[model samples]
Target: MPGYGYVSEEQRGVVLLSDDAVIPQVINDRLVTAFASVTITNANVTGQEILPIHTADSQGPRGDESGWIQVVSARATCSEGIQIKIVLPVHFSIKLAPGQTYPVPLNLSIEGDNAPKSMRIHLDLADLGNTKRWTVSTGEYELERREWGSAYKITFLDYDHSVHYAMAFPPEGNCEQWPEKRCPVVLALHGAGVEASSSYWTESYRRQKNAWVLFPTGRTPWGYDWHGPSFWNIESALDALRLRPGVPDDLVNSVGVNRERLIYAGHSNGGQGAWWLLSHYPDRALAGLPAAGYVKIQFYIPYFMRIGDAYADPLLRGILESAISEHDIDLYASNMAGIPILARTGGSDDNVPPVHSRRLIRMVNEWSRKTTAANLSEIPNQGHWFAGVVDDDVMQSFVDTSLQNASTQGLSLPALPSAFSLSTLNPASSGSKGGIRILQLQVPFRLGTIRVHRQNDQWILNTTNVRRFGFVADDRQEGLQRWSVDGTNFDKPPVVSGKSYLKGEDGIWKVADDMLWISEERHFSTYGPAIHIFDQPFIIVIPSTITERTITYRKMAQHLATSWYLFGRGGTQIVRDVDVLDGIAAQYNMLVLGGPEDNMFTKKRQPGLESMVKFLPGGGFQIDKRVYVDQGTGILFLAPSPTRTRMGLFIAGTDADGLLRAAWTVPFRTGLQVPDYIVLGEEYGDPSTGWTAGDGAPFGGAGTKGAGGVLAAGYWSNHWDFDARCGYLK
Candidate 1:
């Protein structure tokens, strides 16, 4: 075998290590590594030339290195045509032109050890040659190039890290020189299965002229209607994009985006999200276009068929219903009466019924007889996707007309039409855009409503389920010189402090920064035992004693970090209990991983743990004098952090077996059945197999004998006070 040769298997092609790789915005040159394996057919292979080809004919060499691609390294091996590998590391020095997709196709040239430069032979391996391609892009303008968008891992201090991807398209024309010219912004949301970073879902909007389109990953691949923490993820992505490099400064400045012309649009799940965002934060968007979106989760996905709906207890049902009500878009449809909305649904869609959209329109029209009815358009025989529905001229006309109308209305909140009603859940003061000056809520995802009317020189506010609320007013507004509140307990005349009017003596006009607000960052903090340990920035604390179970927990932590990085990109640090510095507890939530016997931190916090669940001396766990001892138990609960008023989640097992069980249950896959607080028993299943209720809880007397042995799965009060009424026990 004198000549160089490469082999290709019939069934497989050259392995492309980085498939659909995204290039994030970077100020300096970046190294991109791609791997492939080339098997030697019969000859000894020495070196290989990896060439990068541009897919587009329009992309030619500029005068400089801007269009040139340099291969930094190409290391290869030769074997029995069976197994050989190569590493191709390329250094991309040129800045990719902003708002363009560069698909780089790779080609390889193989050479024998003694072959002359003139005798080099290029073989297109069936596996590697023409099959591998990489899409590289720069800047966050538009959703046309998905590979250019990188998944960002946002870490919340004392909370978990969230992974989200976002892309921003540049505005048309040269706006940088003319800083006064502002562009309209469209916040686009993706459907359920679509990744936030996928370009396919955002490609249609690229056709819109002179507009800046933002596609946010919405935290998880399948987020829950973009509520709670997911809502914050959208905000965080917007903030990051505003400061990101390569974005034109004029396009991001105060004058760059016509905030008054902001439009929200989504398809399927994102359609539902558009409705959710519009109704909850009515003043944020000037108009909304929700295409093929379901009204609520219960209506979108049947809850009657779900496992949780089988419960018969009135208290349990009430608690579950209350939680579900937070996401019911129809319940808040009345809030959309004043906002300009154009909802669409496919006539032949099977995923989400079209009636949901019709029902929403009807509700909004009925709620506000004074305002014009929100429009609805049905595309005959169209499916759930936005492709056919959004492409319709009617839909495009609606969007353009809405944007033009909003531009004339200016950037402030439009005056509420007569006899208007608004509802909100976890309303933040920051989201108040239009200066409607009605009410702001403090609680997270707690429904609150206000019916307001202006008469002469006073504004009357009829409120419901609003414990902590405030009103904002501009000195320039004429009729609403005074506000009269009806629902809340604040009966006395409001005291004027600064620009806000505080209700009664105890009411503070400032935003309420409490446990409820903190819970929004991490839902498990609100009512725990079932806390999301991975969502917040947390430190795992290990005790001095190193038992077999301790080692298991350490490995579990490593596995969790690896898995999290595999899914997105972020990891938490683990430290010894003794190594924890003095204020560390205040900065990060602690995940104590051992039992009270071995973990000193857990031992020190035993006094506080006694109030929630007590460990019996004879051998079992005790909650309110109910003892469970037969099976080894694992306990998980959330309490006030010993260092501060923040939250701390403690996971400890009765012994080595219990600790091991708790480790496997921390991840959501196997922990979905484990609620706020759980006492796991000896019975267990493979972690690969989903959760089984029998494997956890009610091992002894704590749970009902006939019922699934869930010992304790309920939430504590907002103040960390023990309340039997707040949660349901087995």
Candidate 2:
């Protein structure tokens, strides 16, 4: 009988069974167990996979030293005339010093439920010349020591995905006593391609002595440098840590954080994320350190050759540029004025040019008009990875300074800073900073800033793109006796009610409700007027009943669900319309697929959807006074949820074909051109161009009445109401 052995090409380790080995076969329902012992020595590792062995690409084994190796055992049962395959996982941790070679030894043994099997193999390190220094294995491995930290996984109610994070606690003496003690937190984001699930990455931060180091997976190996959904993943990770039994109750509380001493730091791609989070969420961190980071994706990788840029259409360019502007850190650089930042890059690094960091520092200084620019350090003659960036004296000093400030200030919220500014894209729940609250956002996804400066005895409020905002006054402080709105002086005091206030109509005070204020808990929808849906979890509802033709809708729903999963890294759930429970609408944003007749949820909610678009009986859709009955026509729009104020996206058509065509357009094209609502027309040949094309090909054109092309297209107002003036209907 032939014996089987386990071998790893990447780890350069193998477990071989001798030719004379005898293995046991299970008899009728009997239990069995197997065991193996293996030892390995220096091996000749000459492959690419052996060099960068771990996911983090930082630590591995060396040929000169004895590599750490361990074996896992397993067993399987087999019935008469049946064969089974059993697999076991092996772990290896190796780190070799530079330019060393040594002969390796191997010992092997096997026992239990099988005949004795033994094999020996030696690895030669001579083949790898002085040029190669180290060789390690690919895949996860258990750490030899437990001093680094512990790994954990958590799931949040608002997110469809589970998050993975690593936490490293401070040394015993470093930890403060309970009740009166609060340790500073360092949120260290990993670079692109580094898996936080592995102990290798978390172990690197163990050198930081006095702080609780948090390493979040950023939702995936690659997550847009922690933008959009990735940012939320970090927040959810923090929430999970607070509830963990291992964490002290006072260290991480109900709000999920020790907000005062929070510090953000990152390297490479994570470096970019540190900057992004710092600018967009200034209140979340005390100071930020970004190393070898880029300013924006466009700057890092120019988009001049993209399809949108190739067209060179002013309209198309405007739409594309406006959409991504919210993520451009330079545009929001001024918001970093009040916070401390230390940015660094290696002068010899070619991966990410050092100029990006220099330019950002200059922009922040110019925009804020502050004498002190962001501190920039360029290490000379160093490459992308430099020593002391994470645990250097300079970094330690910065953290110490920030922690001292927090300790002096205690836990109370700081008073509103003089000459401070607040900016946000989604005012509904952006968050409060320095006692100011943004109540409404006139232009969502566009920057809205409120600047306040106390001059002499009056408080002056300077606003841009702001619809409504308020301040929670500290009645104990008596500085400003009057107020000025946009250069207009008002003798009346601002309205105040229950810790919040709204700017009064006549410059007087009016009671304000917390519901109207923007909060960190704000939810977003996918359809128009609420384009930033990444912050909230969403579900897709397919028709419960299916026909031969309606089966295509299932495929369409899959495409959408997959796109969202890839984009957000697992925040999408799919369910049949019948299985969608009553309160689900309130819990998640709904994407209802299929026509009214085919989908139970759509059919039941049709009456409530009439205000937006009505699916008339017999085969057409009615919008206002016009009726669309084209065979290939499809309707995609957003409406208020029947059960709640949240939004629902509806993709319905006259039939299956229309629905498929519309669904395909969304995953491929739909952008600013498709706007809040769109009606796709039949596939036809364009006589003028002699081309067979769909009316919505490329991107759906503006809709018009009596036209076989795009039937209609328009945007909804901020209030989620129809905008007749902005829509097209021939």
Candidate 3:
């Protein structure tokens, strides 16, 4: 009773610590503010005290935390930095030393003669009767909004679809000196739950001299976790800011966002998003600052949470999880070996532990040991959220250093390491490093490493799990010389510009011709589980003619659309088959909801897709001479688009019920894997109640073909053909 207080029947809480402190007398100044450090004793008696200053999810409290406490105070109204925006809370179990006092830094502000002279403050630690209030008096650092730059909105069409983002010019005002003089740009990404509509992103960052800040909503707060479509968001925003099609030339030139001097900075999930771009598109950023970022899905949670994994076969599980494995940040660290990275984290942060930052920095240094491109900044006595985390002097120095490195004319791409290895899991999402790139892998869902060493007379290269690799011809003092790859020697290889070489099925490396390079392979860009289709702009094609199953088709389409918005923040366009024709829709990936008989688009492409699987007149489909006529069977697979270049996803079933079951496999988030082809049955039971699939067991399964309710599941071969070794059929 003494420790806790009751605000209401449902709101029972406790104020761990409270104290009254006098502010510096507003002597001869109109406004005053100071940094006060209050030392408090850890008197929890039970264990270490937790200061949960912020929550990651926009939804609700996770784990053991609860809603924010309703306290009437001016301190609560202040959203000065990332630290005090009170939302859902998560208690990080970080243990501080026993019987020790900790310093809790507080920023106090006062204005005008009428402002409150002194105020009381509360914290998580126990109250100390005798304590000194350490204060550092200084001028009021807060400035007028105009000095911080003006935040404005800009819209652009991404592949004919409308998209908008927030942009701000520097304190020097708009780039009035466009082509004559340009300014740098900072692409600031917001954390999870921080809506793009808020002014926080634009105003939160410290204004850089002659630099513009662009904030793309990333569709929604959690769009692709800032991966897939988020890339397009940033590019479109930059394009609109620098040069737009319809906008007046004066406004366009007013903000010259230099492409060569681009910098990326974010916090929390956004911090992870920064890492994603830093690793995947290293050439795009001059430098990156990721504060409180997590490593990857598996590292975030050791035990898999997907119910399917408990019931999936070992091989099937591998195929499914491989789809997620592409997003693993650690595997792609080699690409960031050349970029300057300053990773920041709270020294005592347990929410997204500091280890994530440490692990990534370690990997980056290991790949670029000579340069040591990445460094870590761990602020002591801080949690997940802290004031001045991204705007600190050290961070400003890193960014300023990167800006100084930019050239006037064009981008200054990092020089290729004389001898460095390039590692990649998905070549499509990964950019070229050290002038070397992997076009495709010998096997899908496996790590591919290409090691290069510069010897005296020639360059040596070795590859593991690599099918094809490419290199650019560059001018050096020694000029083009001999080359050796996988023990095959070549004297003056015929690569005037650049060339790609592939290892044929015979295990011999040969120069890849224009027609045989990356065209006919199941690259990660073209072939993947259910989630891969949303990597780009996709249209949902539903049936034109109305029938008893028409509502079901529409409902399924709507469900897919809503899921994308909720999970990936995707703006998926849904169109009726009759309204849009093949010629116009061919440019976009099509997500056909119903079977060929009901959906005209599917019917038109049935013959083309027959090479792998054939859809029958009714709901039954044929795979490799086997016909599954089960009324409850649902089939979801990937097929070549009408253009024979893009991808088309088919989510169909033998009947209405089966269609609903198939939609269950659409992975909106991580931890769930769906192979290139997956068959769902009624064995999953009703979704409203819960999952009863695999007889309600989630540990281990029998086999791929008949395990759980999965009738069949497997990945397509490099040529997009049925591979006996990679697939299972009933």
Identify the candidate with maximal TM-score.
3
Better of 1 and 3 by lDDT: 3
The CA lDDT of each predicted structure is 0.50, 0.53, 0.61
Predicted candidate 3 versus true structure: per-residue lDDT over 254-373, tens digit per residue: 555575456878888888888988877665667899999889867777746555456656776666567677778888887787678899999999888999999999999888875466
lDDT of 2: 0.53
- Tens digit per residue, CA lDDT, model 2, 1-730: 0122333344443323232111221211211112111122223322211211111111323232223222222222222312333332212212221111211111222232232222222222211121222223212111122221343322232244322333444433343522245555688888888876565666555444445677776666676567655777777666654543234334334223353446788888888888877777666567788888888877877665443233233443443354455567777676676667788788988988899888888876665566574688788898888776555677677766765665566533323345667777554334544445565544444567878786666777776765566665543135567886566666766554443434444644344556433222122343243234445656667775646544466456556755554543442445568756657666666778876877788888888767658888765787767788877677777666654445677887776667765665442211223445667665422322213343445454522212234566554545554546445453
lDDT of candidate 1 over 643-679, digit per residue (tens): 5434566777666556655666654321133444555
Off by over 4 Å in 2: 1-158, 161-163, 169-180, 203-210, 244-257, 309-313, 411-417, 456-458, 471-484, 487-534, 561-573, 578-582, 603-636, 643-645, 653-715, 724-730
Please tell me which model should have the higher lDDT, number 1 or number 2. 2
Top lDDT model: 3
Displacement of residue 325 (Cα, Å) in model 3 is 0.9
User: For candidate 3, what is the TM-score?
Assistant: 0.71
Question: By TM-score, is 2 or 3 better?
Answer: 3
